[model samples]
Target chain A: MVNRMILANVLHRPIRTAVSVLAVAIEVGMVMLVVGLCHGLVNESAKRVEGVGADILVQPPQSSFLFGLSQAPMPMKVGERLEEIPHVLAVTPVLFVVNSVANLSVIYGVDMTSFDRVSGGFVYHAGGPFQAPYDILVDDVYAKANRVKVGQTLNLLSHEFRVAGIVEHGKGARLFIPLATAEDLQGVQDRASIFFVKCTDPAYGDDAAQAIHKLLPKHSVLPIKDYLSLMTSNNLPGLNYFISAMIAIAVAIGFLVIFLSMYTTITERTREIGILKSLGASKRYIIANILREATLLAAVGILAGYGGSLIARRAILAAFPTLSVELTWDWRFYAASLALIGSLLGAFYPALRAAQLDPVDALAYE
Target chain B: MEPIISTKGLKKIFRIGKVDVPALRGVDLRVQEGEFVAVVGPSGCGKSTLLHVLGGLTSPTEGHVLVDGNDFRGMSDADRTRFRRHKIGFVFQRYNLLPTLTARHNISIATHIQGNGFNPHRFQAVTSMLGITEKLEHRPYALSGGEQQRVAIARAVICEPKILLADEPTGNLDTENSQIVLDMMRELNRTFRQTILMITHNLEAAAVADRIIRMRDGRIISD
Candidate 1:
């Protein structure tokens, strides 16, 4: 511990020390940004899949084929027959189309009553919740973009619709309406894209979906949980590999920044380290000193980055308001990981050289 | 009946890339309790290496250094380090005080690290004896070279270590400062019966000690 106190003293180099701290802060900031984006991606996918919350979605096999082929909607009859399933709780048929509500703007529609049961609370940023049929619920993102507000009447597809609420969900501009209104717009049999079903018991969802699929061999029934899980799990084929590659790149960049900062600091303080070793200080003491400095810098850097990322989170959400951005306060993860990595990589050469310092040669070094 | 320090066939061979430079050859030396011995040598003549080996600052490539009948070689590095902290005190040419710390704190750190209880009375006495009382609160950079060396000496002896090893304590100072440092070393040897081994290239400095050993080319040439 001879040079422990001495090495602690040297951590106060004004400009160099601040630059090292900022380097750590920048690395942590970048990491926060990446983690936040990943969370946002997962959240956005889940919100979109479960948006109108049907326990099982029924679509005509041909309709599925058309949409799968050209991203087009199926005729609205498949939703009409889904109520025949024994376990079916509610069958809210949704007509998917890109059509204007009178003279105002293009909108997407879902059955109001079933939408209320499932994805209704997904829009907490607007006026109350969806109530009456033909009462459209617009996503807050589109509302802001179109400068529309709560209780405003919007015309779509040669019909007048009142804006019941503005929802903040994950991605895409959606305007929901009743199945009845959608049928009136496009002639009952030709407009419904999918049927959204809610099972009385959510746990029996997969079985109910299977039974419904068997009932109508030409129709596809998809459970909300299955669809949402597939959309959100991140481990799809090559997706995780891509995300892993990106994280690896971020971490590599962080390591380089920390290494150079610590290396430069070590080079600058070679003489001081030498002098301390000569004063009966052990190699272990010198290494511990460097570790302590790195840990301290990492702590400050992580906190700064976290605070800055909060502002960044707000900005990103504003840019893509449909996204449900998840911000985790798992500060300990970042702090501990950065501290361990910083000390491991940042203090390696410096501590080695500091330990290997021959007091006789070190004293003579100018 | 006991010598405070003794060494037999002490040698240090430094391996630099391919060449083995012998820093110290087989040498025998003895210092009785309370004796102040000065080792004088030319530059690169191995006196400092001998002091280092004797004080347990380093292990010798060959031979044995015995302090108070315990062999320096038999102990582990950790045990040796504790031995060095409790039994040895070092004073170097450049003072080697940490520039960021005040003189009092510098001395206190060495004492504290050894787990030696702080004696405010001893602190006051040591600072007064070394004539560093007024400069105790000042950092090394703020003090003169002579004052800094005095602080270094205070740091070394504060722990009441069994042996004091000073390497060219006044090599960076003027004659007046050198005299002041030497006078303090002599007073410490007299008052506390502290065994002192000082290494220097200056014969004038070595002459003040009770015994003088001269070394050349890593071997003791005369005693």
Candidate 2:
């Protein structure tokens, strides 16, 4: 009966209930978007790193594997030296460059022969293998978005190149060209951004990375698995804090809105609360009534938020074709729980106030 | 026989800006079990305050209240709340029925708060006796004043509490409705053998009770 009364009370003022539900829904939606974007970025980064299929990445000492954009480039000769080491089957030197057109695009320049030996060769959707110096490869998503096709010429850093092939999505970089061509365009000859070292056995990746670290004591040698762990765990500099702040802000918005709404509701029902007390309602009974109302509102908000987030993800992907926004079940469950917990916390004080109201004074309230 | 409701030298004071305004000034009273007692007084004569104290809604400033052999002063707030749920029923002048619930739900809510699920037999008997069985599905707004009050009465007595405290139950009703409500209360008192303490200012309404206690300036003047 108390539960029914609570539901009826929530429906009693439809406008207020709608507003509260909307507020919670918006907060949950925003949190889901933020969390989804973070997870998508991490997952995509790990995929790209794993796509390299290298046992170890050797870069400048202070460089980060997250962006892979280091001002100081490593010498291409480092690959030859790494290949001389035992258990190192193949070595590929790649140049990482960021091109600014309408938006920032990451470009990878690789020696096709050794790159394919170290990393499994790319699977082409349109055409196969680069034949000319300026032949380029693009992912399917990028190709579709940019309307690029085989036998079409595209510009990269004021240099024109023919589209050699369109690879499957998630295969490699959005833009890929010959290492010599990238070196010519960037005016950085005989130097590469990083070295990808493949071991004879996949299980020897850790040993290979340690050996590389010893050989090139001045440079950084990181195992691919470690880089992935760092990205997923949010241990990268300032990333964890940024995600935490976004989550905190989302929870605060939900909590404050629910708290104010329930507090005002309790105040408006002061006389009714007194009447309940006079009817032999315990404090727990009163609290349960208020919380039941809040929980119902939160449940509606959570469902709305989940639906809204799916639509938002589609809209976002359509607007920004290059960006990845992952809406996993884990994140959806997390968003719903956060909203419910925030709303319950918000109702706590108001429920307490209702329970503490003096029956005589409350009944006398006009 | 021991009194169902007893207060010894009960006093209640309201503090307004450091001024202690006495509402119930050291009044001792008792009503035997199964008796319908009416307290008649003018506005501000402390009849409502006395009722509030007796119902355990408010505590006395300087005296103790013993209802059905349990001292309210010896119980904590939570304990008093439990005590009231099991032992006391209250009817207010405003008809205090939850507007969002049907008459049946309002009546059943009392049993719910008492931690007992609805008893269909007692509910049917009470609503049938109060002549509100046909109006059970209607919300309070759809009911007439007399019907609303009867629903309120059914709600108050549904749990079969040991004592019933009514604060001006008919203060807002017309003479016809007031008489009808008063007659129902008298019938309920006789049928259930439950003690009832009512506060009112109407002499005719007081006539239905087994005894009338009149008050003046927060003190009983005539019985």
Candidate 3:
């Protein structure tokens, strides 16, 4: 009966309930979207790292952020020296440059023969491998999104190149060209971005990395597994703080909305509360009633927020294909739990006020 | 027989912006078990204040209230709340039924507040006696004034409290509805041996009680 009363009370004030639910939904949706994007980023970065299929990666010391993008160019001759290391089967030098023309596109320049050897080679979906100096390969997703097909000419860094082939999804970069061509175009002929070193045996990766680190102590030599772990753990600078701030904002939004709504509701029901007290309702009973209402509202809001977030993810990916938004179950659960906690906290003060009202005065209240 | 309620020198002062206005002044009163006592007075005569104090809804400024031999003055606020839930039931002039709940739910909530589940037999007996069984599904707004007041009375007595406190339970009803509510209270008192303390300005309403006490300016003028 008390539960029914709570449900009835929520339905009695439609506008207030709607506003509260909408506020919670918005907060949950924001958290879902932000966390989803964060997960997507982590997943995409890990996939890119693993895609290299390298036992060890050597890059300039400071390039530990964003998959070595921040690193200064290392000398291409580092690959030749790494090839001299024991248990090192192949060494491929690659350059990565971010071009901001029609959104950010990562351009990778790789030595095709050594890249295929070190990175298990790519599976072509259309056309054939790079045939000319300026030939390029675009991944399936990017090719379809941008409407680029085989034999089509596309511009990167104000230089035009024919799309030589289409690679399988998650193969490598959206745009891959010959190593010398990218170096010449970027005016860094003798510089390479990073070196991918494949060990003769999988178990020798850690040993090979340690040996390379000894030779070039000024640079970072990390096994591929360690780099992937770093990305998944969100140890990157500013990333953890950014995620924490987004979660805090989401919680605040949920808290403030529920607080205002429940507070006003308790104020409006002051006389009713007084009557309930007169009839022998304890403070715990009153608080339980208020909390039950809040929980119901949060439950509805979470369901709606989950649906809205899924739709938002679809819309976001539709508009910006490059921006990955992964709506994973873990992120959704986190959003729901945070929203529930926030709303319950928000309703606490109002429930306490309701329970503390003087029954005599409340009954006499007009 | 032991007195179900007793108050000695009960005083209640209202501080209106630092001005001490006395609402109850050294009033002594007692009602025995199973007694139906009516307190009658003009407005601002502290009739309601005395009822509130006796019901444990408010504390006296300087007095001792003993209900069923339990000293109310010594009990904490939380203790008083628990005491009221277990021992007292109240009917308000406004028919303080939860507007959002059905008549049945409003009555059932009284039991729920007691931390005891509903007793189907007691529910049937009360609703049947009050003639509210058919109207149980209707919310308060859909009920007539007489029906709403009856539902309120039913809610008050559903838990079989030792004492029932009523503050002008018929103030909002028409003459016919008022009489019906009064008769229900009289019937409840007679049938269940329930003790009742009612505050009212209506002499006819007071006449239905076993005894009437009149108050003037916060003191009992006559009994």
Candidate 4:
């Protein structure tokens, strides 16, 4: 019967209940989307780097692990010296340039022969590799997202280029331009931003990386697996703090809305409290009733948020093929726990106040 | 049998702001088991306060009230709540039913609060006795003044508490509904031997009880 009363009470004010549920859902959704996007971008970038088949990565001094974000190029002579390191089978010097046009993209400038020697050559889906200085190759995901064909003309970075081929995704960057054409466009001749080194044996990557560090002490040389680990949210600069701030904002929104809703409900239902007390309801009973109602609302909110985030993730990936959003079970559990704990804390004061109301005064309330 | 309820020099003072205003002053009372007694008085004459104190809804300023052999003065608030759950039932003016619940649920909630769960047998008999078996499916807003009060009465007695305390059960009812509710109470007392302590200002409502105690100035003037 107490359960019946609780259900009846929750359903009594439909508009209020909906607003409370929606508030909590929004909070959960915000937290899920933020975390998903952060982890997704990091993991996807790491996977693409691993796909390049480079056993060791050589970057310029003070450069970010994010290749596209760094524009400072090292001398091409550095690539020649890197190839001389013991156990290094091949070295591919590539220029990383950021193209901020209709979308922010990283255009890889590569010498096709050496790039293929270091990383296995691109798997073409349509046409062949670039044949002219103005020619470009796009990955399949980019092709599908922009509806580009092998013969399509594209204008990027204020320069016109024809799409020579569509290649399979997960090779370093979305758009590929020849090394000479990239240097010509940037006016930085004979310079490369990163060196991708393939070792004779995959197990000898650490030795190759240690040799490169000794050769170029100022540059960052990391084994592929170690570099991938550095790309996670916790290891990335400022990302963990950003995620924490977003989660705090979501929790605050949930807390304030639940608190106000429950407090107003208690005040409006003062007479009802009196009736329950008159029916021999204990203080613990009253507190439990309010808390249980809040818990039910939070539970529904979590389910909605989980479903909403999944749908949103799919829609986002569809709209932007190169983008990824990962919604893992661990984060889902965390979001649910955060929302439940926030809602319970929000309802605590109101529950206590309701329990403390004098039966005589509550009954006399207008 | 000893009186099921006994109050000696019962006093209840309501402090409004700075002044000490007394609602019940040195009132002594007794009601035997299975007796239907009426407490009648004018407005602010402490009859309602007396009912509230007897029902354990409020504490007395200075007095002792023993109901079913349990001394209320020595009992904590939790103890009083437990005692009220098992030993007493209350019917109020204005029907005081949880408007959100159906009549049946509102009536059955008493049994639920007592932690005995629902009693289908007692519920069927009690609703049948009150002539509200058909109206149990409706909410309080859909019921008439008399129907709501009857539902409240059923709720009060569904658990078979030792004493039923009613504060003007018919104060809001029309003539026909008032007579029907009073007759039902009288029938409930005779059939179930239910002990009823009803507080009211209506002489006609008090006429249905076996005895009437009248009060004035917060003290019993006559019995």
Best by DockQ: 3
Question: How much of the true contact map at the interface does candidate 2 reproduce, as a fraction?
Answer: 0.85
Off by over 4 Å in 1: A1-11, A48-53, A59-75, A87-89, A94-138, A145-193, A199-207, A217-220, A236-239, A274-279, A318-320, A331-339, B73-80, B116-121
* Model 1 chain A poorest ten-residue lDDT run: A63-72
lDDT for residue A120 in candidate 1, whole number 0-100? 44
Instruction: Score candidate 1 by lDDT.
Output: 0.71
User: What would the per-residue lDDT of candidate 3 be over residues A1-366, giving only the tens digit for each residue?
Assistant: 767788889999999999889888888899889878877867786786678788888888878646435556888888899999999999998888777887765778988899999888988889878899889888887887888899999888788889999987664566789888878877787778888899999899989998999999988888988877777536767777888898899889899999999999998999999989998788888899999999999999999899889899999888877678888888788889999999999999999999999998888777
Which lDDT tens digits does candidate 2 get at residues A1-366? 877898889989888898889878887898888878878877886787678788787888788775545767878888789998888999888888787877777788888998889888887899978899899999888888888999899987787889999987663467889999889877898888888888999788888887888899988888878767767736667777887898889888889999999999999999999989998788898998999899999999988888888899899889877778887888778888999999999999999999999999999888
Reference-based lDDT, each prediction: 0.71, 0.87, 0.87, 0.91
Worst 10 residues of 3 chain A by lDDT: A63-72
- TM-scores (chain A) of the candidates: 0.73, 0.93, 0.93, 0.96
Model 3, runs deviating above 4 Å: A65-72
Residue-wise C-alpha lDDT for candidate 2, range B91-145, written one tens digit per residue: 9899998889999999999998887878999999999999999999999999999
| Per-residue alpha-carbon lDDT of candidate 1 for residues A130-228, written as tens digits (9 for 90 to 100) | 567668777766688567888889876656778887777542226667666666665655566666787777787888888887777766656766556
Steric clashes per prediction: 13, 0, 1, 0
Which lDDT tens digits does candidate 3 get at residues B1-223? 7688988898999899989999999898889999999999999999988888888888889987899888987788888888888889888888888899899899988998897878999999999999999999999999998899889889988899999999998889889888889999999999999899999999999999999999999999998
Estimate the lDDT of model 2: 0.87
